[model samples]
Target: MMKKTDGEKNKFSLWLLAWPIFIEQFLQFLLGSVDTLMVSKISDNAVAVVGFSNQLFNALMTLFATVASGAGIVIAQKIGSRKDEEARTVAIIAFKVTTWIGVFLSILLIAIPAPIATMLQMPEELLPLAKIYISIVGGGMILTAMMSVLGTAIRNTGNTKGPMMIAVGMNIVHIILNYCFIFGAFGFPQWGLTGVAISTVTSRLLATVVLFLMFLGTFERKMGMKDFSIFDRKLFKEILTIGWPLGVNSGSWVFSQLAIFSFLAILGSSELAARTYMSTLESFCFLLGFSLALAAQIQIAHLYGAGKIKEAYKAVYRVLAIGLPLVIVNAFILVLFGGNVLSLFTKDQEILTICASLLWMNLLLQPGKMINMALGNSLNAVGDTRYTMIVSLIFMWLIATGCSYLYGVHLGWGIIAIYACMIVDEYIRGVLSFVRWRGRKYLRMKETELERESTKFTESFASPSM
Candidate 1:
């Protein structure tokens, strides 16, 4: 019953969505990378502090991602099903839930950053800088949470360009603020790491406000207070049902990376700095694939919702075919030019040397990761979240975390060994995820659920009123 233009608008095309998302994510990456690059000029220790604090912040952001992911998938499906009113309701709930969660987390982090830092085994010398960064940046997590949910909602509506434009404006503002605050340029006080944190939080606040305004424009009718006041319990449950697994899965990945960072911390500050620098560079490659996978997820969710199972299945392969080669080529380019790129962050021969080795290892690492991302995300699109969640939890903790410790810390094999363990982990998870998608079990399960729901609706109408 949807109009042709409406259907075309909602239809999933990889390039149309992916390009904006890629640019948005890239600028977002640049936001952090700029912080790292600017802070590195101050000292490697400062860079380490920023890296550690961001990891903790990212872990917290995963909690927000839970609601965003759930809301996005549900909204995409509803849009596909022509359930516009329900989709708008889901968006309102997402914004409300993330706001409350964000406020609580922001307060918690602001109140006791030191204890969290201590629990994470933060290096003694780095604690002072870490406390300041965590308190200010972490305290503003509400902005990030709001921004994340807003962006996800906007993107699911296939309006990726809006968020991408916001990111562009945000980065321009962030860079200018960073220069002013970090260096005391233009009469701004030199606040060092605190300045960087302030700049980050301020930019995020502005971005969130703009995104919220854009969100309101997505719906045709005005969304008054009453629309938000109504609580749709069933829809909320559905969001949580799809979202919690994603949260847990992301939490596991973040924790494992944190564990790796912990192990690297034990190796010394040089190792930690190397990890931070390498991560920034590595993101350049993975974000391409990540963007593509995200686009595919949006498309696949639409197809799945419309009961176009064959198209959904084919879509994953198309993404993989495109994503794998692109990622591989990008990874190779990084390997070839990595030393020059890394040199932008640090001049220390030791850190540069460590980064160079990791770049070669990355060539092997990225392809497997691309597979995991494309297929795993495709599976998530179809609501087979539990499978990806369980697999990630098992492998990430056991292989990525455990082996990193066993090889890098306990065995004294060092950071390269830890990187090897990660490579092993990615390929294993990638294989299992591919197997799950190929089996077609999720498609069958979805069909069964749809039939059951249809039957129940029919029975409700057929039976006498109570």
Candidate 2:
């Protein structure tokens, strides 16, 4: 059913891999909307707290994601190399390490939620909710991290359906639980923001458990006690090599979001709510692009790790062709109905006014973000991560952050101004990504002496790096 190359382009199979990812992400994006809708009903403060805590939550996840990214790369490489037993070993190590990391990080996250929130300038009235929010979510952080490790492994091996199905089910669980806990339905105590957090954790735990079991049952490269043997220092090192850069890249760049969100909070609760709603809505439109990018990374990694350089390049181009058109359409919708979409979030007149203007920028942002995200992830998949690190620091930190500050805080242009700056930055970074991909910089870098062997492919198939 899943062919190595259909018509030498393999476009259909590639899209098949990508589409399930789209469903998975779309489902996940819906959960973000769920948070905004449920919390916004509570208060703008509730919305801000959810957004704020989530940024920190993403930050915490990056720790595990970094290592999981490495594990995924290893899985790709090993599978491409036909080193099935080794891939299983790498998966076991990755999951165990991630689980332990999650446990430790959860402690720190719970202990210092307030201090972090304070540094982000949480309003006094909102601080308590933020604390509760972080605590509940943080308790389940390990489950989230474990899921990423296992999920990435599954995706690396070309099994996309389970994850998407799990997500659809999880989102439904999340929403049902959200209603029960948030409103204190069916004898449940009303916990408001904290209830949302509880639902989130519970859902994640369910997903992680299911995926873990699937890992054992589905794969030829099964996880057993051998992979978890702590004495296997070499396996851990291999996972770290692929994972660290990804972790740092994700961590360093995403922290910029944290900074931006903090700035929004300072603008007032209404503005924060608007920004939160905008982000949630934007997720739906961009998720297809994100799914394509993820698929590209997996496919490219498989090819490159198998030494199929030409195929890797060809695969990425196909990914762009399919993903770009979708982005354009999604962005156009945002441009056309920005106001109406803003209306869905709130009735606050002040927020509606600010968000309405901000929606236009989503047109520019959607495409640009898609470009950079595709290029960046594809490059990283092939182990050319240094380029992403340098590029992200320049654009995400220097340009995006600078313009945001100049417009939002320094120039007093408000939230719209901040978003305008964000759109500009996205455009710049997106163009950079396109240029790099077209020039084949990442491909050449992957072909370099030290790493070229990491990517290998052939007629039947190829193994991605492990």
Estimate, for each residue in 323-369, the C-alpha lDDT of model 2 and write its tens digit: 78898898788778767866766788988887777677777778778
TM-score of each: 0.95, 0.90
Count of steric clashes across candidates, in order: 0, 23
lDDT of 1: 0.88
Writing each residue's lDDT as its tens digit, candidate 1 over 310-377 gives: 88899989888888998889899999898997888888999999998999999999999999999988
Candidate 2: where are CA atoms >4 Å away? Answer: 1-12, 230-232, 439-466
Q: lDDT of all predictions, in order shown?
A: 0.88, 0.78
TM-score of 1: 0.95
Clash-forming residue pairs, model 1 = none
Weakest ten-residue segment in model 2 by summed lDDT: 457-466
